[model samples]
Target: MKLKTALPYVLLLLPLAAFAAPGSQSGEIRFTGQIVNSGCAVARVGALSAAQSRQVEIKPGLKVEVDTDRNACGHQSLPISMSYEALKTSTDKGIVTITYL
Candidate 1:
């Protein structure tokens, strides 16, 4: 009888155990490659956000597709770079593909 009573308590702690682990629940992947000028990469993923590093120069003619949380999406082709310090504080999520030119 005591063993049976403890089962429910054990079950209740499972959720807490999962959260105690360090990692992200958000489904996001980051990929980096050299910018090769003319090819475009498509990332079919979930909610997306982007940040560019200002301290370094991003390859020119880079394009991105930010498919919205909804079925709708947005695209951008620009030149920029992100500072390492800035990247640490960024909340940008989703699939990132870098094409080398």
Candidate 2:
């Protein structure tokens, strides 16, 4: 008896439910950007023989790129070594002195 009264309304909603979301939907979203550093703390600006390894020799004309697992700005490695966390903290505090030989 109640079904007879609700039959038309249920029939109307059946189409809406079936077509609301036909099937599963999926895809992908990706993002990209550019980061440019205007300058760095050193005697030279852009020109430096850079190596992405620590085992490489550090000569006067060479700027050994170190701790680059994070960004491209980690060059200018020295005879000294410091953990990335420490270096970041040090830099965040103030300018890190680079003694000239």
* TM-score against truth, every candidate: 0.23, 0.25
- The reply for model 2, stretches above 4 Å from the true place, is 26-101
lDDT of 1 by residue, 1-101 (tens): 99999999999999999989878749888679964443332333322343411112223333334332222121343332222222455645323434332
Per-residue lDDT tens digits for candidate 2, residues 23-94, read 755665556975453222232334334443333223433333333322333455343432222246563333
Best by lDDT: 2
* Candidate 1 displacement at residue 19 in angstroms: 0.9
